[model samples]
Target: MRIRIGGEVHHGDAVDLRGVDADATAVRETLDLAADDPLATVSATPPALSVALAAAARERGHDHPNDAEIERLRAALATTEPPDSSDPAVDLATARRRAAEAGSDVARLRERVATLRGRLRERRGGDAEPGTSAGEAESLAEVESAFEAATRALTEAETERVAARQALSRATERARRARDASERERSRRDALANRRREARAALARELWDEFWTAFDAVAADAPATDHVGDDPTAFDGDPVAGHAAAVRLARRDDPVVVSAPLFDDEAAATVRDRLRAPVVLVSAP
Candidate 1:
């Protein structure tokens, strides 16, 4: 039979197929052998010879290649020879290389886990270690347990901080209330003292007015200018009472001799000696 394989032409010795049955299995085996041949070239571009090969395969009930067939074809194309089983040194070197790669992967994973743990601790404001008592966490369960404990401790600390703040606020309020009360009491006491002083001043003024009025009346009732002595205007008694008594005695129209206890005893004696009248000097109790 004459056939075109890739861009090359070939002539194969013809075989008699008069009674041969072309089945799906026979066609699949033939295709597999052709693909495995190093000289056989199958183009991946469109309108290529592989299209005619696939059409021939479909006609033989092979249809399209499945995943397993594709993988087998890839493996067959990737390797030109079988691995040497007699070379122990080569096998050992390959194994060591693979082991080194696996170790590197494990180390990278551990570094990633440590980074995540550090971030978690920072977020929680925790000072505790990330792992369990054994140093590195052996399993997910141990890590979970440590995280739960940290969460509980953080919650407790926050609760205590809130309570302390509340206590301080309450104490500050009490102090403020005490200060306000003390200030109000002091103001009330000062106001009461001021009122007492005003009352005493008013009383002193009223007494002075009464004493002056009594002295004027007694001087008016004197018979002669000589008989009338200089007025004893100072007194120790209630001025209102003294003036009333002096007025009644002066109304008698007789030679009046006024005698009263007065605070300015020297002035009273001078008036008494000048008028030759009876006058009394009384000391304040």
Candidate 2:
């Protein structure tokens, strides 16, 4: 059977070891399962052991309930005939219920006893009682005062305990949410990094294509002989063509960074004046 233990899943034994003499192998196996589970307790109580075994079964992913399977396992665990008794182990549910009721009873009884003691103390003193003045320490009044003090102390302690539990619960929830948010942030960052990589790769491809196109145009329009004899200079206003010429000239260098041109509005006037070669106006970084 499946059960929820400490907010986690658990599975019960398949075999009805309830009335059987369980063997060492079954016990060892159950212990082994419990040992692997962080939440499972490894105490001496059979009820606790049963709970751990149940948790182990849940961990193993047993969803269907099978009484026949349980009986088979029970047979393997036993060396003799099963006992005809019902109380094989303690029921955790019943135990918790009883404990809650007992605590309530204790609280009620304490209040009742305090009330009774206060009443009894109030009845002790006569009209002209011994002690100080009328407003001062009377024995009955003192007893009632002490009882009130004790009750107040107990109430304060219980309140503190409740507040502490609530604070811890809130803190745990906040921590869990923070952890979840951190994971989401990490995933988002990784996705952004991948997108940036893709963009850079695409940019590189575009740059390569532009460079190749400029080279091809220059090679097709110019002569293949001596540089000065077959002039490649422009005399007219062809800003677009001049830009392409500058790009081609820049590409001729083995190290492109040293030869790459910087676009300047003043470069058009300079190019119109000196029409010998592609002029590059670049700033050193």
Candidate 3:
């Protein structure tokens, strides 16, 4: 349902289909005028849009008429039953309305052309014409004189048009390359982010298992107060091996050990109170 229209255009020609949503009869009439009239610039009818318009007319209680029938209906729609225009004022008003519409259309077309020229200039860079610098208007005259000396120089209009096309092409190529590179970078960053997330999850699981095991082993041999000691002297019968085991358990996640120690028996009792397991120790040392 989204229709986006943009990109570099090498050609200046345009085909407007603004009133395409109207009924088939109206569309056929428009088409006939477009084909015969000097002002009509619509070159090709879009098949998809034509069909949709016909269907919409049918849904709105107007049957889709055949081409000949459509033409007849269009004539009826455009012309009055008793067409006898004698008043010059009415004719003048009609002419004015049409002139205003034509002026509006021309204004819109000119604006489009100006926009296209601006884009081409942006691609070329700098405000000076192709071969000249900002402060050197006299040099531009000299450049033109030199260009005239060449055996096969293009007409002024043709040269400007060729320059515009080249600028448009370069701009398009740059945009395409930029888009492709951005997509690649985004894909690479997403892959790296996913890898980091997975690594962190694995590291967290490893740390959780290590801490649980160390807490279990310490609780089995120590009083809560000794285990919680801020600076416990090594007891006569304390198991140095148990502390070593805890140290090995804590190493995997790069945990910094400070003066604080776990109140192992109290921690164990709380685990039992909560109906959780006596921490299962795994050998990762």
Candidate 4:
């Protein structure tokens, strides 16, 4: 709210450009305020009303998302990729089948070897049964070898099945976590968007109405503004005068610098009268 020009600091609510150059470094510095700044020194422009409302909203801790921010949030909510279970399911089935096949083969071969050994024992230390004893002995040796091989295969298959079970469990847990995460993210985004929208909408309604009433009350005593008596968003008047009034009125403590040209000869007097904030006027050379 304080203006420092030509190494002299002037403190006030309103200021005059007077003989000062419009492009002076101090003038530029005074006019630029942060979005959330309650105080502003700015040229009265047509969009000044919108700017004022936004600043007021920021001070109130309400977020007003711009188009770019809205689009970014939309994109974030659109993409979801979860862990896959189909491939793991197929692997589990394959492992189970291999384990069962190996077990059956081992069992059949063990039974055959047992039967052959029993037959050989019946003819032990005697002349071999020419038709059957020698053949049975050879068959027993082959069946034992096959049983050993089958047993090894069964052990390997059992290991694979156990691994498959673990894989399936991991995949399921991952999928559940993925689903929960996505849902939580989506809910957070939706709630954020809703709050911002509601806050801005409420701000616009209250601020616009307040602006209209204040502007009307000051009409008789203050310099004329080029407003068409409609919504500030649709305002087609001088950017500096009417909206600047709304901005200054938004808060009582903030100093707002105004250009001398926006008003008539009565500017300084009316500024002091209608606006409680003290102002000093200077013209741009």
Top candidate, metric TM-score? 4
Task: Select the stronger candidate by lDDT from 2 and 4.
Answer: 4
lDDT by candidate, in order shown:
0.37, 0.38, 0.34, 0.55
lDDT string, candidate 4, 135-154, tens digits: 66776566556556666665
Query: Model 3, range 49-167, lDDT digits (tens) per residue?
Result: 11222222232234321434444444544452332334434444555555555555555555555555555445345435575555565544444454443312234334544555555
> How do all models score by TM-score?
0.27, 0.30, 0.25, 0.41
Q: Which ten residues in a row have the lowest lDDT in candidate 4?
A: 37-46
lDDT of 2 by residue, 1-285 (tens): 342322444343221222233332343343343334322211112122122223323333433334345444444434433432432123333444455555565576578657857675555544356644655446557666667766766676566556555555555555565556556655655655554344333332333323334434533343332222111221232323323333342322111111112222334334323222222222222
Ranking of all predicted structures according to lDDT, beginning with the best and ending with the worst: 4, 2, 1, 3
* Candidate 1, 52-110: lDDT as tens digits: 22322232234221434444444543453433344444444554555555555555555
The alpha-carbon lDDT assigned to residue 155 of candidate 2 equals 75
Clashing pairs in 1: none
Q: Candidate 2: which pairs clash?
A: 11-54, 14-70, 15-70, 23-77
Question: Model 2: how far is 117 from its true place, Å?
Answer: 10
TM-score, cand. 1: 0.27
Off by over 4 Å in 2: 1-144, 212-285
Between candidates 1 and 3, the one scoring higher on TM-score is 1
TM-score-wise, the better of 2 and 3 is 2
Best by lDDT: 4
Clashes of 3: 0
